[model samples]
Target chain A: MSALIEVKNLTLKFRTDEGLVTAVDDVSFTIDKGQVMGLVGESGSGKSVTAKALMHLNAKNAVYSPESKITLHTENGPVDVLSLKTARELKVVRGGAISMIFQEPMASFAPAITIGDQMVEQLQLHGDLSKAKAKAISVEMLDRVGISDPARRFDQYAFELSGGMRQRAMIAMALSTKPKLLIADEPTTALDVTIQAQVIDLMKDLVTEFHMGIIFITHDLGVIAQTADKVAVKYLGRIVEEGPVREVIRNPKHPYTQGLLAALPKLDDLDAPLTPVAGDIPSPLERPSGCVFHTRCPKIIGDVCKSKLPHDTQVDGSHRVACHLHTEVPA
Target chain B: MSETLIKARDLSVGFKIGSGFFGKSILKAVDHVDIDIEKGSFFGLVGESGSGKTTLGRALLKAVPITGGTAHYADGEVDYDLTTLAGPELKDYRKRAQLIFQDPYAALSPRMTVRDIIAEPLEVMGLTKTREETDARVREIAAKCRLNLEHLRRFPHAFSGGQRQRISIARALVSGPKFVVADESVAALDVSIQADVLNLLKELQRDLKITFLFISHDLSVVAHTCDHLAVMYLGRLVESAPTREVFKAPRHPYTKALFSAIPSLDPDDRGSAQKLEGEIPSPTNQPPGCKFHTRCPFVVDRCKVEEPVLEHPGDGHEVACHRWRELADTLAA
Candidate 1:
């Protein structure tokens, strides 16, 4: 279980018009080689921000804490991602070791350039490969990702392809460089169910072949259950629970995790009513004083849940929960 | 069992594509679709993008021009042919039917307050007499949607995605529409909030007795929320059945493939999905025979030449597949 990337004490805030809004607070997680870590969260949960922080891809308004650290291990050595200031120094972390695919492939791809051109450009930038070699590598990657007629598809622009193909092309482009870590932030969210399944299968096959660590971020518990080896449930910019995917999904320790699972419309039980988390997720500007999830936590014990933030309590060997109900022992 | 609130026979919506004389062609977005929405039933229409599920829903609502076929809107009290509906009847139909848009962020106007947003529909439809009457209706509907009266004064920018979606729902329901078309209404929402909105919609259906034409690509959500289901592919209704029957014994290949494609919550259930190959064909240039023959696994020579009409094998489960009879036998085994 050799770690590929390690993030610790990651506290991020954005300089907004209202005030400094905390996006990711004291969030720490790790991904190992050939493992998939699912970061599950809703809109304001800061899952995307945490993934962006891994590659130092946060917006200009983002301000990281002094104690924040992201360590990425490569063949060369362990590099501190935060310390890499210059673009030249950061290239090692950017596309060489870390590649990301977004929710919308169309937004990520350039309208004018063909999908092949983008892949070739990425390959040449990261590796000392000739133009012809780059083209061949791009075509092979496209074919590997299940794109039909790779040579003809190589000449087609992003707009020329359908939604599924565009997504496959994006996946093809990301894996062409053979990065050690792939951060796919809601990669299948924009796609249809059938296409989503296909993409998920492709990703699983890629993981087994490439043996690369993947950070799969999505709010979908089903997707997490199918794809992820480990799961981390985030709420209001903090990890409320973490455990093995099966354990976390089957027996979620945190109230937020339990609420999320209960909220899902299960196909197995069509008669069961969907039970949503009690209250709405509070605004970031007016964040709660203690636990961020206290407002919505159905298992809130007492004033302690509303007054003091609970520390992470280990439930089992690998399962851990951050809720006052689990952490505090009332006499 | 109940009275049919909306009925359509071979309804088609065609849009003229291309500009030049020779290049001009009619893109039949909704092609020869037959559907029935029983009163007080949640009917789910499921399909991938470009499948024309949205267009079919819109055509039913009279939001789009129906180029062919006939549709009827009979809520027991009022009976009107949706196709030839004009002038006062069309205006009256607008009050009876409404659409809930998918994206809450783009649906609501940022300039308008929540109160005005909900009230706009009522005022435009001339449902209320005065501002006092409009405010009363808005407050009533907003409260039903779990929106606070204080929150009504705030602009759309101040609310979250879930809150904005509630506002959208309140606006849609404020007009007191008997038939509502919710097109991917909860697709943009998170799973947690999505459940809340879905529950709200279900509650609204039971309390208000509104027939919802719920259009979405999510099979799991549709399975739980809807009483009846229709699967569309390439602008054609491939299968229509009771929700339980559709889940229990799906006759159509596309429908069965759709069910398998939904990612299971159990980790052990890996990629055993019946993966469908090839993309949905473009509506502009559909295949010669069955539109789905290109991707159909059991496709044969006959499927490529002659289109299969919707056939009821038994129990009112209509399936549009040339080989469904054989497929059902195999599925049974």
Candidate 2:
């Protein structure tokens, strides 16, 4: 199947007081229909920034490179995302083909409005449906997401619902639009583990039924491994590694990826000592000269790693990593 | 076994809710909890929200008012009944037991430098005779937390989440407490940075030989760090066991469901996991009888009427369940 969304050389920067700070640097990836791509990164790693750029939802100070391009394969045709300027033009991409949910359900929802009113409004805005039909669709969507007594919950405000319920409501609202690409940014980070498992299962089921491409952004490797088909590891705005989820989890190629996996507290082994990445992630202000990870990388070679940028190396048919230790650079 | 640092029997903490028309109903956040912590061991408390894990942790440290039962704290020479500690005894206990907050961003004062923030506890508690002595203690703890001397002069906002957490740890350790309650300490951190903070905590625990009450909802984290584990459900102790035993073979249905709920790293190994349905019951309006019966997959009719007491099942493991043996046998068959 052809890819659903393709992001190529998408360089994004914010105009901070300290000058242009690159949030996403030369990142490229693709997600096909019925596929789930996991964007994994730590804070300041720019995973959220990259996701935001897809819907043109970044802050006003965000400056995109001229060469950057994002193509969305909608039912109509392939449409360019970055060039859409007007809100009328942006509507087709914002909620039509793409829908996004956040880590904090409260932040995503309007606190004063009832969940039913908001969901119906979103449906009417995105599709040509009557108010009654939209309301019926909203309740059905809520019930589909496992929210019990959907009609009763429909009239409750965001505060009236519990954390898990609010998240489910948010998912219901997002999926009610039937967007071809769903971006879930740390959707389960604020939830309890059991609730998180339910949400993950619900999302997986939705993907199978709806056949929509999903971009799951989270820092938890376990969640990514369980939900994602393809995984992309980001560090300080750069894609350090990208591969099939099984291959990436089974045998990581990048040193940073290895450190992250090693650092996780594994359920199978209680005796293993968690070794953290050698040093702290460098401040965005002090962006490294050549290799972004050289300062913290454990297997750093001689001065070449310090002075030169590492090219991407193909480890297998699909696994790719960017590090000097993984590939030789021509003199 | 090592010397017992703290011991409690039938401890309960209750808060008055809706004073007017509700007639001041007592909401029992912690109901009849019994816990024992060995000296210098990591005792973990795991539970979902409204599970009373935080309240239970605070009760042991005397941060919350204990409504009933008795608690004793003894670290070799200094010994005091925590529930009845008062005046000079309470003041002394404050120095012996301390708490580390969950959010590092809000834990530290924005105006204070890192050195002053870490040194405030020493100065307030009269642990140091002079500023020089306070600085020395702050420097020692800061070095242990892997913070450089230059980082001491910066404000709390100047540092990252992991660095700020280290500063908070240094502050908590400046008073040289014997017992520490870390409530969801690393929950706000990234996974990689979480490992860093966890390692620092383990190292500090070893070097200083301080007993820790680690309260968190993450079972994987507790399994790796804690020597013993206690599972709480709606203010009750449902299960308690050694870390290895609990992970290897959990007896409580709630505990088993909780384990199965964790998303496995293997993509294809999504076993017929016993998924717990519904949210944790609110503490104010808790379920009658067994609190977990509302969500327990293997719940029976008997569980709907009578609450189960903690029963020992050998190997230092205690499970509160009416049908663990029967359930285990059925599963085996």
Candidate 3:
């Protein structure tokens, strides 16, 4: 299959009062058409920042490196995302071709306006559609998302809906535009397990039906395992491991990935002790000199880990890991 | 047999809602429930959003009022009836029972230093006579919680989520509580950090001999840490049993569904879980009969009209489902 989007050396940093905090450093990945790429990381790992960079949605204080390039392969041609400056020029990538769903569904929707109006407005903004046509498609998307009484729910405010229903409405709104790419940022984190199950099922079904590429960003590796075709394990703004979901999860190469997998409480083995990744994640301002994960890495090798960054080394056909253990000596 | 630290029979906690004298309605957050927590055991209470697990934890700590039924707390020295214990006896019970909140950021005061936050409890309870004594107690508990003594001088803002939680744990344990209620204490932290906190709690429970009523929605975490487990649905206990027993063979349909809902780490195990349809019903407008019947896949005519009572099905397992036996037989067949 052809690549839908290609990101090369996408480095981003925010100008804070303290200093320039590098949120996304030398990150690169690709998502094929109708494929889902999972970005798994803890807070401040720059997964969300990388996703936001795809649509040029970062704040004004954000700065991108000269080498950073994001090329969106549209039907017409490849569009450079970073080069787009004005809102009009960025419109094609923003909600036109790419749509985002936040963690909190309640905060995503307007409290005063009805759910139907917002969805209809989004549809109209993306393409040329009449008020009647927009409303018709909006209600259909709502019903398609498993919301009961779609017509009645369309007229109700966001506050009237429950947490699960509000999330369904948010999904419906995001999909109403029927964009080519969907960026779901911790969409199921706020939901309960049962409700989260429902949402995950809905997303999987939608992916099959729409055949759209998805960048699923979340901290839950379990959710990522279920939804993603390929997985990228990020830590401290860098991709520590990247490979097919099964390969990375089953045969992890990086110490950070292994630590993450070990930390999770597995239902199959209740007797196993939960061994956490040692030490706390360093503050973004203190960004480690060489390998960002060197502080907490249990499988540290020689002085190279502390002084020099390890380049991504191929473990198998598609599996790649950036760790001192995976790298070969220069001898 | 292990001693019972907390025993509740038909314990209920109801809050009156609405404003006017005429316009008043009771919201029974904790309905009629029976539970016995063995001393020195990590007992877990699992449920969804409106399952009343938090309310039950609070009622046991005497943080909320018990509108009906009875609850007893026994630790060999003092056995206080939680429902009626007031005045001096109630004041004494406060020190013996404490709570660890879910959000460490919200739970800790921004203005107070770690030392002051942990020492606040001892100072209020008068557990320590002098400033030196309070400092000593704070330092000792802080050390036990794996908090740095130098960091205690810094404000809560200086610490990360995991570190802040350690401070919260130190504050809760400062009073030397026998029975502690950890209500989603590790839920807010990342998975890697969550394990550290869980290990800390388990270690502390062993070292201090504290009986923890661990409340969380995540079954996987509870499976490894908690010895006994209770599943609640809409303010009612649907099932209660040993953790291994519940995981091996869950009797209640709700419990089975909960186990299946947890996303497996294996990518190939997709869509295998029996996903429950519909959201949890509002607490104010709860349905009659079985609270879980509205979302249950095996709802019968009787389940729609008549509620099931807790029944002992052997091996110390308790289930409140009428068709559990028949369902088990069918599964076996």
Candidate 4:
């Protein structure tokens, strides 16, 4: 299998009022074709910013390092995402080759626009289709999403639909363009558990059918456990742990991963007390030195964790963690 | 077992909608509910979004009007009928029975500092005679909620989602209430943060001996936090039993489907055999017979014509379903 996308030495900083906040620092990862990769992290961890960086959709305040590279696998050849400056030049990759779903469907969609029109407009942007043909395909896409009376629902506005339906419509709009990559940023956050389960099932099926690479970004460990083929745990914009989803969830080597997993409430054992990492997740503006997690880490040892950042240590052939505890300190 | 702290008999909550020209219809948010919550019990109300779990919690707190039936609240000294509670009795009940809202971000006054946010409850209820007393009470509860005294001086925006929820907890508890209604308190938080808040609540309940009416739409969270579980659907209680018993044997088809819907921590579990179909019916136009018969898979002809009453099947378990006996037999088989 070849890499569908490759991110290398990506470092992005924002000129916030507080200071220059490092959102994503030296973050590098790859997603293979047809694989679902989940970027797990809490708020302000910069998981969403990294996904935004892929589409070059960062705000004007963003400052990216020169060494940062983002390449997309396309029919023509490998295209550098950062090099595409022209709107027309970026269009091929933005919506044609890559599509993104947001946390709130209402924000992404026009409240007055019918669900079908938005989808048709998206298709029209990339493909040369007549109004009637686009309408037909839009109805088909809505039906594909398991929406009852697809034709009727397609005509209804976003507000008219339920929370679950709005999300499904957004998914439909994103997929109707037939993009190779889907950036789902907490797509199921607003949905109910049962509806979330259904949406997860739909996304899984879409991956199989479209052969699309998905960057499923969410704070939910359980959803990742059920869906993602591979997982990367992020802390303060850094990848602390990256491996196959099963290996990462079952035997996480990073203290942060262990803490996060231990914190999740479990139905299997109700008596367990969730020992959350000793303190609050530090603010992005006041990030701790040497190790980002040292501020809240229970097992922070000596001068090594306080003065020097640790290298990525391989726990197994497939698993890797960035922590001083995992590797011996240098003299 | 401790004496019943709350006894709600045939409780119903209805909202008069429209009011004039276009239409007029009675929206029954909670209808014909009967429940007994013992002192110090972590009683859970679980259901889907439109299932009236929150409404039931609010009704118990006297936040909503009780349209029909009687709800009795008696904790040793005071016994006040909820529907008729007013004046001094109602004011007193406000101090004893409080509600913790779902969203911490919205619940806390953003402009107010954490100290004032938590102290507002004590001040409003006149639980403390002076400002200093209120401040002292707020600090104590905040500390109990795992919030530091230093953090109390800052605004809510300065804290994390977890910390803000703790502030909300501090406010709910500063009144020194004997019973609390935590209505989806952990719903807005991440899974990791959820457990932290839940643990604090459990600890508070243990030390204070406060009976909690924990209401949530998520069954998995409820399964872990609650001792007794009550499943509500379309304003009706479908099933009520001990958490262990319900987890072991969910008598109602609704409860069975709910349990199966949860994405099991086990990897191999596909949730293929068990999946609920159709959305919950709109409350305004609820199905007449068994309100749930529209989506229930095992609905016999009788299920569509007559409503099922909450009946004791055996043990302490109660289920409102015509086919629960048959469902239980199938599970046994």
Cα lDDT listed for each candidate: 0.92, 0.91, 0.93, 0.88
Q: Mind giving the per-residue lDDT tens digits that candidate 4 earns over A164-255? A: 88899899999988998999999988777777888888898899899999999988888888889889999999999999988998898889
CA error at residue A204 for candidate 4, angstroms: 1.3
Give me the displacement of residue A284 in model 3, in angstroms.
1.3
* Clash-forming residue pairs, model 2: none
Judged by lDDT against the true structure, how good is candidate 2?
A: 0.91
Highest lDDT scorer: 3
- Candidate 4: C-alpha RMSD after superposition: 2.1
**Model 2 misplaced regions, further than 4 Å:** A329-331, B20-22, B329-333
Per-residue lDDT of model 3, residues A170-204, tens digit only: 98998888888999999998888999999999999
lDDT of candidate 2 over A268-297, digit per residue (tens): 778889988878888888899788999988
Clashing pairs in 3: none
- Clashing pairs in model 4, backbone N/Cα/C closer than 3 A: none
* Docking class of predicted structure 4: medium
TM-score of 2: 0.97
Per-candidate count of clashing residue pairs (backbone under 3 Å) = 0, 0, 0, 0
Ranking by DockQ: 3, 1, 2, 4
Q: Candidate 4: how close is chain B to the reference, as a TM-score?
A: 0.96
Candidate 3's displacement at residue A320, Å, is 1.0
